[model samples]
Target: MSNIIAIDSDIDRLARKLEHEARLFAARSRNAEAPRSRSWIVVDLEFLFDRSRYEAYSIAEGKDAEEKIRWPFHQVAAVCWMKMEFVRGEPVPMIEGPFVLAAGEMNERAMVSALFATLENNPDAIVTTWGGEARDLAVLRRAAATLDLQLPHQLIDGSPYARERLDLCRATCVQADSVHLPEMAAAVSVPSKPSPSKKIGVLCEAGDWSAVRDQVLADVLTTSVLAVRHLAAHREIECHRADTMTAIADATLSAIPTSGFARKTFAPWARGEKAASQLRGVVYRAAA
Candidate 1:
């Protein structure tokens, strides 16, 4: 296992070196203004499992518990991703998606392959996550290896794209343990996970894909809003810009059908955005 990790590290280094040369050549070839827009892909994944299948072996035995006790998994149930595009001079990025690739609909291998294809096609785009380096990506690596699949090199450690990826948990964590996504959402006053992730496994077992999709979608939206809020709080962008981002996210959530699980899941966020807008208006008038 250590050897595999070492090999992946070596591959990432080589890819980075080649990519750096390519970027230098491109920069010399074109002295144009920076591209008008760029994007970040925010991802969250949920696993599918059945406890009865693992009843024979204790939690410590069935799935490489010795090496990866943090996330021992047999399958990825869903892959949810969002693309936020930032136009130069714009206050906030436009939110494009919180698309779900359900394993039940397309099969696990195919779903993973689709995500890998998306990442490979967008080498320049940043990949954002709450704690992906430790959990989501780790689980994907193991799943890919078991399935004889290949992941995008940019996702590998030490790639030139290392700086292009944002692990929000790493950004905010002060200690060894990561701050949970829901807690961060609460801190930033954004919509949060509608249900515990363990509920995903339960839903999957019951073939409740719609509910699972809605839950994962809510999670990705929460992460996206939290990213903008984090940036503002850290002065990466102005607070007003963060407000714009939050408003767009709320709109995206509102567009979901009222009968769907997300409408109820994000009702609090919708109410909050309305109230916040009113308060911002008063503050602007007072300043004027």
Candidate 2:
């Protein structure tokens, strides 16, 4: 495990170096106007997962697939971005994506090319992400390398990019005791990722791709919100309730409807129906 991490770090280093020349060209041709403001770019990525019966499209996917058995089988589904800048010295935030750049959506080369193109337009942009330095960026960097794609100059370490890579995930991890992204965000009152509708594979296979896109959008926004709130030194937003536990186990049971219970001798129909409905809803996960 340690060796793999070290090797991945080396890959990221090489990818950054390989992209150096192209990044410069891209930065020069991009819209330089944003540099006038103190702009920071907050980004998040959502990769699609397969069941190993499919092919890996992104380097991140391949790396993930290599470790897992017949599970995981990951691929780059999309990338999302949120831009925050000081306009007239007041903070303003805007969302930029749900950029679906996977191979199935379009030709893989063209999709990746467009992503880099978009990044090129923001030369002086300060890159920020939740856990980008260690995960997102490294994965993206590796993917670009695998494709022989040149990343934007800002992607390669230089003045603004490296110094300004504010990985809120890394910063908050030690403080938050390594709790996951959504938990950390919620504790600080930043809206977290919505409850996932279903497993990614199920949604993808069932042709519910829109759900995946929606999830990515929610995540990126949550990540951006968390970063902005933390930067502003916002207080912990979670309200600690005096009564934390609800006594649903001994609650009132009434009403009647269709019941899934298989009892031939049931006199009290209303009570049975209520128990069945409430019991399933509260105890088990809601039906997908």
Candidate 3:
């Protein structure tokens, strides 16, 4: 009986491996034939959790204290998504968002549900993220389950869209496990985090919801720029076109009527602009 059980377990493991491989092969074939998605949804989430408690629990369990909590113990502090629409013949994409939901202003379950609704409503847009596949999506899945909410079909089991997720960490990072969003964005000349991640949690703890919102907004903007750069790298758009789209993105942010949050969040990017202007001026003067 023991021998039979061992053999059955081995067979089940092998079957699962084969099924996963089969799905991968099918996904690859479909990707090769499908045209690139013109509509893109770039998303990022910020969570607030009790770090001290998590650390104490992990140490007691003899696990790495630094390991991110996999359970839905964290509250969704903010959820921000930027929608970019690419016209067939346009050089620069149009930006529709930076739509944000904050926990202080809304219930946690409602925030998570809003994200699911966004996915369901924009079924055709390709959802893009930095470490979304492993981090953001994992937390979202657990959060939805805990909240007793039904996930969108796009994120549901066996959904082809779920398999087709564009995780930039995997797509652009040679060392996906080690590379972070700031490093990846820097590599492509995109604006990075406005403030340290540690500060986000600190601000949340102090009930500085606006400050947390600023940090979340900054992250989403960085991710949005990175996504456009990825398209250029893949030859979906021209390099100059990517630059134009980025400038347009900057303009959109500037036009938004917000508090000092927007100004502070975008300051780092302003330095980049100044540097670029200096370089252009040098080239033009030298040519005169």
Please tell me which predicted candidate would have the highest TM-score against the true structure. Answer: 1
Q: How well is each residue in 42-69 modelled by candidate 1, as lDDT tens digits?
A: 8888777535445544554756433422
User: For residue 101, what is the lDDT in candidate 2?
Assistant: 37
Off by over 4 Å in 1: 1-36, 50-72, 158-161, 235-247, 250-261, 265-271, 278-288
Q: Which residue pairs clash within candidate 1?
A: none
Clash pairs for candidate 2: 23-153
Q: Which tens-of-lDDT digit does each residue in 1-288 have in candidate 3?
A: 999999999999999999999999999997677555467788888887857778778889775445776445577888888777776556667676777788889977989898888888888777788877766777788787888998776566533236446777777765545578877666656566766766777787787877777777777777777777678779665435434544545654665447354555444454444456546334221210
> For model 1, where is the 10-residue window of minimal lDDT?
279-288
**Reference-based lDDT, each prediction:** 0.70, 0.51, 0.70
Instruction: For candidate 1, give the lDDT of residue 268.
Output: 52
Task: Give the worst 10-residue stretch by lDDT in candidate 2.
Answer: 243-252
- Measured against the true structure, the TM-scores of the candidates, in listed sequence, are 0.70, 0.54, 0.70
Question: What's the residue-level lDDT of 93 in candidate 3?
Answer: 73
Query: Per-residue error at 106 for model 2, in Å?
Result: 2.6
The predicted structure with the larger TM-score, 1 or 3, is 1
